[model samples]
Target chain A: MRVSLSTLRILVLLGVFIATVLFFASQIDGYMNARLFNRISGSVAVIALIAVGQAFVVLTRNIDLSIGSVVGCTAYFTGGILMAWPDLPPVLVPVLAMAIGAAFGAFNGFLVARFRLPSIIVTLATLAIFRSILVQSSDGSSITTDRLPAWLTEFATMNAFTVGDLQVRWIVVISLLVVLTAHVFLTRFRAGRTFYAIGSNPDAAAFAGLNAARTIFLAFVISGALAGLAGFLFLSRFGNITVVAGLGLELKSVGAVVVGGVNIFGGSGNVLGVLIGAALIDLIDTSLVRWALVSEFWREAVLGLLILLAVAADTVLMRRLLRRKGGAA
Target chain B: MTWMRSWEGFLFLVLVLIYALNAWTSPVFLTVGNQINMVQLSVEKIIVALVMTFVIINGEIDLSVASVMGLAACAFGWMVQAGVPGGWAIVIALGIGLACGAFNALFIVGFGIPSLVVTLATMIAFRGFARVLVEDRGISGFPDWFNALGQRGLVGPVPLAIIMFAVLAVLAFLILQRTAFGRKVYFIGANRAVAEYSGLDVRSVKIRIFIASGTVSALAGIMFAARVGAIRGDIAQGFELDIITMVLLGGVSIFGGAGTMSGTILAILIVLALRNGMALQNITGHIQTGVLGVLLILSVMVPIIRETGSRLLARVR
Candidate 1:
């Protein structure tokens, strides 16, 4: 059987994930417990959402460095709104958050698509601008758990069902559904495939009658909306929102996207791989705290190392694979 | 000269208007002391910005520069605390910076990875290393002379940092505008394949530029440590924002192969003046950052807007 390159990448990634979990299980006492699964899965849900969003942007050969800021902004704003109106419908709150996030993402997309500016530079500016807006608006205040509605705060740990000491939370299920939906959309829909077409070759895509600019714009919008959704999840999970709430998550999401076998340069990858990547990263990050030998300060360094290694390994493996295929042809 | 009608010229006019406005608004804005103080505060970023101009112009970026600065500063602090001589500590800290740069170059050039991804990872890793070295503790109380080099004005009201900036600015201009190596940077950035076919050692040029960025960033880090008279794990964190802002605002193309050192210097002045003016008016740091972010976006957008407007006009004609 001949597996496609992306499928092979995902398979290799799954193998690595299992190997890593097994390695950690042996290294740490009681590492294979249900509590570990619950903690890691809950955290992975937040990161996985953002990583999926980042994958959309990266798919179109653009990036949204401002996603972290968008997450922070939406989370804080959503928290503020919920605190003001505790009786508001739960569905409306996430909609409002997604609306706010989409607005910010539209601004980024407009600048990049309309002006044909480099997405990296534009998003980099928006990143600071969005954070600064949060800082200015928040006025040195934070949204604490005490002010949040009980339902929202309790939703974080509310389990959907338990399977032999392992409890599956609602947020995890929502995240998984999102990943699967995005996966189907990207593979099965014509419009969704435009992202890959444009990313793989913008000129050729344009020549083939595709609206590259519009696709790029849509990618950012999706990224922003998803990030906003993640922000809502973030608020529910933590129940505390600060101006720095989503700081450093931009890098983390990018780490997940790249490590999940998505080409950083764009045109390849899937959300399912990103979900596994998020789980792998959060697993290491949470596990490192209990590993004893690695200090807390070393976590960010390990994340960086993992990204570099992932990129290097992808390049080497792909090259070897391509060469072998060329020889056969 | 046609240069007077270019973007830098327009920036010069804006600079003058800002200076006038600042002078009008604040009583002490025009004073030599205030002017020197303004430059003193951001001298390190501007210095690093000088090298960053080269990196951007060469079609690459070093996001790791700020983290490299943090690492160098923290390493120096740790070594001093470990009883290493201050002088030796400075040397070793700089060596660490060079190593960090070489590490970036190795992956970027050797492994064929994009500079953005490589530097992003290193940015985190380098800052991580800094945090590990200092571990939330503030290191201070350096030898008196070492502090004096950063704090005191060696040339009568002009501190050593200012003097260094001046010398480096001139050298950067001369090297960029007048040297064959400068030409190679532009050629490689403009079209790497063509440059290679034309027999330029594109790899060597890129490697050298990154190494220079690392070294300059380290020097800036050391200067930061000296000026603040303290060191911590988060030293120079987010400084890349301002440094890159300066370079990009100066009209350096993010895509590489175009820009001038003179534009960057003017941008440095404009940014420093803007920040200083805002501080004089008691604007908070975050709000000021917000303004710079706006400027950063506008700087990139305005030119494209102009070009498109002109094209539309031509079409109508």
Candidate 2:
């Protein structure tokens, strides 16, 4: 009959979400509601995609701070390619971006797994290194709509389906599918399950014959690849690309994953929770603009506060769980 | 230790080599005025780096230091612009830094949360706070007397800020290398549980170290504002990387329980000279940052490589 802290948190989050939606519904008309949903889904898609990858890394007790830079670099790289070859196939662009991201991730993995350097330090270096390269390569110039291929821009606006006059973008569906697949993999796959073992206690996992370093390395790679994918989505959604396109997104992904009930110290939490967490964050972000109670300037501050609160709550709940276990034993 | 035997010695040689290269290549490199200006550019960052050395040596980090510097700088500028005395504004800036550090320590030491997570959150939060406080506009136009201390020389070619850095470096070196408090920081970093069991008050030491980081960061913030004569929320953006680069490049182990003030000083000088040399050669800022990033990765990698190589050799024997 004892529900875990994570389950309790999810329930509380659901209640808050429902209340917020109801409050907004009462304040705004049905047309505005549809518009809000459309906006939320569109913004949440890229954020959720990055958050899912971050969740994988966090579940392995490693963080990929370079994710934002990877997304930025990949976006710029994609932009560069499209500008170079206006006739290039749309599908191949994403593949190229993912490959680039994977390479970056592999570099991070080698340093972390092979050298045993901390993920934070390695990714922190890569974060600057990658962004600096992007800036240097671009020479501070940005890729605008005029440079992008016509098909890619059209693909950005293509609708997946309409539900009662509410049109959902194809990008949202793609992000949702990503979430579903990641959820199943985390729940069922042996490789995914090994992440928890490594995250919770790498020494114990190593003793049990798990290649903790390799697993952690793979986590970083997956995170990187997903970030690249997210970059593709970012490019399609926003045609204008700057050198700082994905700046501070690593913070956003970490915030989403932690808020989704995945422990910041790693191990535990689900993708479904991350989906909800991403939605909540984007909702708050947009709401700041809509409500005008607080300025949009406070978005980063709020994200930070959310992370701190979530971690603090998790810590207290975990201690309680431990105390209860000790009492029963 | 022999000159060639220590990391500081290695850094010294690198410094000399860079000096030689710069001297041979750039016409302005060897002048006393230019050299002073070169060292002056990094004084604030080096000040922050000195405290960061202690934080890293204690097996903790405060990513919020740069943000703290920004916020404090902005606050000082705002206060001075609002007609508060410059000296009082500096005090207020340092106070803000102290509060910021205490906030980090409370969550980290009191709540028993990881310093990384705590500082990461504060880093974002504090920067956001700075943005909200100053918005997009920058504050400037400080008094002549205040500007003189940070931007000009008090003692013939030695800017007041440089003197401050030197005095602080010596103090940090003494405290870290000579005092009981310094020894305890190392003990706690090496093994926190063991240190705690021995009743060395690990939490207090961590709190003190974090506070020192905040205070020093604030001092740097005030100095930076004086030199630049402007304060923006974005001041010191990405400076955490440079400060960390210096600490790591100085041979300070990111893992904690290792590093020295002298190593950090030499590393700071090397970076300052390298930056100056690059500027003289007309290298762009982004390229400089890229080089530093590569240097940071290599700084941590080389030691690990050496250790592993030694282990492999031992196993082979």
Top model by DockQ, which number?
1
Encode model 2's per-residue lDDT on A1-329: one tens digit a residue: 99865677788878777776776556545625677778889989999999999998899888889999999988888888889988887778888888888888888988888878888888888898998889988988898877798878787778999998687999899999999999999989988899888988888998999998888889888888989999988888888989889999999899889888898888788888898888888887777666544667787778788889889988888899899999999
Listed models, DockQ each: 0.78, 0.74
Per-candidate alpha-carbon RMSD to the true structure = 1.5, 2.1
Residue A324 error, candidate 2, Å: 1.0
* Residue A328, candidate 2: C-alpha displacement in angstroms: 0.9
Q: How does residue B280 of candidate 2 score in lDDT?
A: 91
User: Tens digits of per-residue lDDT for model 1 on A120-181?
Assistant: 88888899999999999999999999999998988889998899999999999988999999
Per-candidate chain B TM: 0.97, 0.95
Cα-based lDDT for every prediction: 0.91, 0.87
List the candidates' TM-scores in order: 0.98, 0.96
Model 2 CA deviation exceeding 4 Å by range: A1-5, A20-32, B1-3, B308-317
